[model samples]
Target: MTQQTQEPTTAELSAGYAAGLDPREVAETILTRIAAREPVLNAFYLHDPAQVRTDAAASAARWAAGTQRSAYDGVPVTVKENIPRAGHPVPSGTAIANPPVAATNAPVTDRLLEAGMVILGSTTMPDWGMLSSGVSSLHGVSRNAWDPSLTTGGSSAGAGAAAAAGYGPLHVGTDIGGSIRLPGTWAGLATLKPSAGLVPLHAPYLGRVAGPLTRTIADSAALMSIISRPDARDYSTRPYPQMDWNKRLSSPRGLRVGLQLDAGSGAPVDPEVAAAVQLAAELFAAAGATVVPVAPFMSAAMLTGIDAFWRTRSWADYRALDEAAQASVLPYIARWCSAGKDSDGAATIENYQRFAQLQQVTRQATESLDLVLSPVAPMAAFGAEHPMPSNDPDEPMSHISFTLPYNMSGQPAATVNCGFTTDGRTIGLQVAGRTGADEDVLAACAWFEGVRGDAAPDWSLVP
Candidate 1:
């Protein structure tokens, strides 16, 4: 009745058996939960019931043979529609690719499959992973299970929503520009945007990397272990760290934590979001992580430049299509794509310089710290009716401000639920790491989750 208290899947199972719940039963229970929630939440692009059974059966067999695939074996997992899965469509939420057929599973996706995580099907993303808010003109909008009117942050919108709603115990998503972190934050889930290139992007666009969204930090780490494997199929993947990611680590306190609360947008981040971030900074300091407040978050010019480069991407590619093909895309995606086609390279160049500048500054600023913490968004998820902004792609676009810097800097960044807005929308606290300090980011985030006591935000108890 009251949702089987959510079972430990994959990595979660190793630390301890979860109330005697077997991985097989966990998969079945999650499928049942998905059936009950998907109609209202619409979290998945499509799921093959038979495939779930086949994968689960294989995982159970592995478990019986004493050779269960890592922690996630048998876990029901969902991937972002934008990530190519062999023989499936990776639409990027576009009408042009409505069928989203993929010739091969993305390297990151392949890693998950190799680990024995069963795919529940694909979740939605903004058209071409463009929109800042979850509202994709293509697949309609992925509602925030926490607050339907608001959003399930995106371009990993449905990925976050699905995880939040208990559709899958684990979710995989791409984050070129907060695709993973944003939706996870909005949906009150835990997510990581590994340093650019940490995970491979075998799909057409090369900048994005795959990361996981989940109910627990351990689940996220487990998913990462599967997805982070360097693959010969994709040249883009980095070699796996020589160290074991599963090893237990020490607390983050006593570690220097830089706080970056502002961005180049020059617009004020919501006060509530700010307070929540400060609370996080304070928590780190109190717990022994040295928290330093950094001033004048990235400049407005830098902010605008970063915003344009990341936001304009989906559209830049969109212009190559004919009118009818364009029309076939989501309304908002079409609108956004239209805007990008006209914007001169100057738009991208400005973003490029800002990116270089930010990387320089980010490196300089954080040289003293182990990590930087900040707000995920200025505002909480707005109702579905609220028109998601598609302002000029050139100047600092508003929503992407809080989340896209990492995409530009190619650094690891994470979003953990910090606080909820007065309206009940969730506020996300982002923690970014020095270039390639991804596991550290996850370790710190997991430590925070352990202290926080909540995995995904329990909306009913948010207040």
Candidate 2:
């Protein structure tokens, strides 16, 4: 039996854990975490134990060479199946690996490898990352660490569980809706949705790439530094800066937080969630930040359309990638390929135009607001059987009302634990920045990590 020894954290392990606290040793810890919890949590869709060991061995060698890429070197991190993982089956966790191990890694993976992060394996995801409930027909459901009975949110289920279980210090997951944010919040970890172009998706889900299942904001930023670059292969990179994120100052030199007063929708937040947001507001104010109200809440109508757009657009594309490619996927996936197929071309065109208009509106309103803050999901983790609550959030039609718009606008976003409910469920505070404001968003996230109630992961209660 692997005795859990308050296992050294990402930071501590970087300094000591694996063979001499080497990353490979840290990889062993991840393998251990998976072995102990996988039977119950079922977080991974497909993890290659052999690869993990081989990578760990290399990680040890890197450490021995006094050239571990970064302190993160050797840490076996999980990747959501949606994003490309060069050569690995990225059927988004439908039917094992999709793109044959011969494919090249996603830019993020290249960055992860460059940063010395050992690729543990792919994590579970809803078919195509289209669903928000986190349960996949392929891997089943990813349970919340706080309460195994509830959802750890979705699309990044494996990423969230791996982090919550201390599988590794970080993870990589993309989010068009709340895929990244919801998982991190539900799993009680920090997550960031880089401005659309910051970390180019390269292939599918190319428009939005958010960091998920990370233990701390620093690792997320560090990962960003490695991956965010001008990749000629990715056209989206043209709009983002090619500058190095390592050049970014982690310090929040007195932030200007724009508080979303109503959070619009009259969507009543759980008292605990509300308290967490309020507490976060107070902390930001205390930390030399001037908090003020900001705008850009989606009208009730726009809320419903957001999820509709993501599902229809994502599935329609998933449907195109050749039969042989698609066959490797799950049946439920083929089912969701057109849930929103009825979305008229006119509606899509109009909605597409709305995205541009939304951007301008955000510019006018947020030109002066440094970072905007709100409840990550407006709720706590839910039951595992149903990725969502049996009873919907106030807006029953829009499960992802809070997160999708940002993805639509291509802005950077992040969720950090602010407080816990009386029932002990974790709540997250999301902070987003205007376009091209990734560094600013990261700076703000680092602030939250330092001050807000580190509500993520009650390891003491980890099942």
What is the C-alpha lDDT profile of model 2 across 1-463, one tens digit per residue? 2334444545655667334765555666678777888787777766888888888888788778787778767756777776577655665655544334526767776777777777777777766665566576567777765567878777787788777776676678777667889877777777888777666666634346656567677767666666675566666664665544443444444777787645454355667776788788877787678888766466655555554565467667766778766666655555544565777898776655655655555556566877888887767887787635533322333446567667767777788777788877878888888778777677677766765545545565565
The C-alpha stretches of model 2 lying farther than 4 A from their native spots are 1-11, 17-20, 67-71, 95-102, 204-207, 239-254, 265-267, 314-339, 390-397, 453-457
Taking all chains together, the TM-score of candidate 2 against the true structure is 0.86
Cα-based TM-score, every candidate: 0.89, 0.86
Error of 2 at 21 (Å): 3.5
lDDT score, residue 277, model 1?
A: 80
Model 1 residue 58 CA deviation in Å: 2.6
- Judge candidate 1 against the unseen true structure and give its global Cα lDDT, from 0 to 1: 0.70
